[model samples]
Target: RFGMLETVSEFAGEQLAAHGELEMVRGQHARYFLALGEAAAPHLRVAGQTAWMDRLEAEHPNLRAALAWLLAAREGEEAVRLAGALWWFWYIRGYPSEGQQWLSRTLASGGSSIARAAALVGAGWFALDQGDVTPGLAALEEAVALQRAAGDRQGIATALNWLGNAYVHERQYARAEQIHTEVLALRRQLDDQPGIAASLANLAGC
Candidate 1:
């Protein structure tokens, strides 16, 4: 099923390349192009990956492919799903500011609070990467609150992990430790191998 979708998407992309008028193909062509871009995203992380993403973004400049790839990777099942959600949140629009605005719009809605929380988490990370601490902390805190309200254990743990890093960035070791401790405990309970390794590494450094 997935492979068929990939092939269809790829074929559609090839067709789109032959004809610049996405409007000509309208519904199915446009949809297939988007699907193919996403389908190829995971494989794009290998050496030749950026070229495809670049091609997709250049052809579909109206879409937010670049920003989506920036926010999350297309690696592994869970990561891909998370990246897809991020892509949908921002990629329905354009780059950076507009993409963030679209993300904010979805977060503004009350439905899918968990998804909104995840969006905020992505925002927080983006802000921090840009060297803006205030907005980053604000977004991370909101994500933590939303995850808590939604009772999403996994989301809560992930938010806490990032929150701990934000705290550490501000030289608030105590607060960082508190959040990290919570993540560590949850990771232990879940027996998440990678999470455990990250938590242990953080603790060791602390």
Candidate 2:
């Protein structure tokens, strides 16, 4: 949890630029945090949730710095990876607005289909949370399509789950039920107990 004052950080940045090492150093920093985010992603969903959340929270500023550097460098794929990994943290920690902005930027920059799909899931959820239905639905639908194309069953299930939630939010009960039913079937095949329970709850709500 070490940090420098704003002025000190700015001064260090200037020095790095003067030394012509800024890009290299920033790239390294971004990659390091990218790995950290990816490692924490699963933990955030289940076991060690609180511990992982706290660790991520402590590194939030550094994570933002890494993402900013990646975006500034036009490293689209890395940016997408980092944003995709961290979106859940932003969502649960109540930073959906910021998360949406980062995801939007990464998406616009473009990346691999699978990575982009993951980012879309995050973007879609944030948009829905912010009450923007059209873009939200569009993003989620696109993500599901991409995941299907890639044969990423888990990814498809996750995207479908969110898509179902979006339909529920829009009060499209029948559509939501259909989507959740599909998700439930997928979860059962995967033997994901948590996902099965969630899908059942979603179906019940629908």
Best by TM-score: 2
Candidate 1 clashing pairs, residues 3+ apart or interchain? 44-49
Q: After superposition on all CA atoms, how large is the RMSD of candidate 1?
A: 9.2
Q: Give me the displacement of residue 36 in model 2, in angstroms.
A: 1.2
Tens digits of per-residue lDDT for model 2, 1-206: 43789899899989999999988987888899999999998788887799999999999999999989888898999899889999999999988889999999989987899889889999998888888889999999999999999998899999899899999999999999999999999999999999999898899999
> lDDT per residue, candidate 1, 45-133, as tens digits?
35675666565555553334432332333212322233334443334234556545545544543335565666777677667756889
Worst 10 residues of 2 by lDDT: 1-10
Best by lDDT: 2
The root-mean-square deviation over C-alpha atoms between each candidate and the true structure, in angstroms, is: 9.2, 1.9
How far is 132's C-alpha from truth in model 2 (Å)? Answer: 1.2
Please state the error at residue 29 of candidate 1 in Å. 7.5
Error of 1 at 68 (Å): 13
lDDT values for all models: 0.62, 0.91
